[model samples]
Target: MKTLTKEMQAAITPDMALDLLKQGNARFVNNLKINRNLLQQANETSDGQHPFAVILSCIDSRTSAELIFDQGLGDIFSVRVAGNIINEDILGSMEFGCKVAGSKIIVVLGHTKCGAIKGACDHVEMGNLTALLTKIRPAVDEELTITENRNSSNPEFVEKVSEINVKRTVRSIVERSPILRDMIKAGEIQIVGGIHDITTGVVQFHEVESL
Candidate 1:
């Protein structure tokens, strides 16, 4: 596969961009990686980059978006943070990725057994991490189904909070950034959420929710 050019990126619809990720993840799960020359891609994208998607995922070592999505150089813009939490800076980055950089889709990717979600579940605090984990507390609050073990020790609760955090981050991206929101309304971009199964290496994308 060749690197995406300006016209190629422009030709891709929001839905098509999402399909590309789905196909990539399928390849990753099955170990059917497409052959591509990384050096050639590096040179091809040297002057400019026309990535089709912007993925915001956790900073976990196991959940590298590019590797899990099986994308080559310049295929996507990756924005990672613990818990995949949304903040002013993340919002601005998404706006730049879509409105300025012409990316077709924005993905908030959470993962099962995420450390950040686990920390939020237990209310663990330590310096700056405390503030960062606080951003995910709302997701824990939103999860009302788990009444018994509402802590990270329970695998079920951790996964539930992780999904909720991804959805919340997706909502925040659309609602917080007018540039991205306007672009979504104009049919230029789509924002979606997903969860990566650490054990299985499968990314389950949620239904697209643009604007």
Candidate 2:
């Protein structure tokens, strides 16, 4: 596959953009790859980028959205942060990726065994990161199934909080950004959430909430 051009990106529907990521993840899980010259794609996208989807994921080294989605240069916009939490900066980036640049879909991609989620689960505090972890505390609170072992020591609690955080970020995006919310209502774009299994390399996508 070649790098996406302005027209190509424009032609892709929100569903098609999502399907592309799903197919790419399938390839990733099977250790498959598309034969594309990275250098050539670099030159192709030098003038401008027309990415079809914008993915907000964690800053985990193991969870690079480009690699996991098997997308080449200019295929997608990646906005990464700890916990994949929603904030003003992230919201602005998504707005630019879609309303300004014409991306078709937005994905809040979280992963298993996320350190930030763990910190939130444990209520870790140590400077600026304390504030960041606070953003994830709501998700940790929403994970009600784990009563006894609510801290990071329990893997199940951490993972549950991870999943909840992704879904929350997905909704928060729509709730926070009026530009994106209007775009969603006008059928111009869409938002969804998913969890990336680190060991398996398979991303289990969640439902796109109608909110």
**Candidate 1 overall Cα lDDT vs. reference?**
0.92
The CA lDDT of each predicted structure is 0.92, 0.93
Which residue pairs clash in candidate 2?
A: none
Clashing pairs in 1: none
Runs of candidate 1 exceeding 4 Å displacement? none
Task: Report lDDT (Cα) of residue 148, candidate 1.
Answer: 92
Worst 10 residues of 1 by lDDT: 169-178
In candidate 1, residue 65 scores what lDDT?
91
Q: Which residues of candidate 2, in runs, are more than 4 Å off?
A: none
Question: Residues 69-117, candidate 1, lDDT per residue (tens digit)?
Answer: 9999999999999999988988888888888888999999999999999
TM-score of 1: 0.98
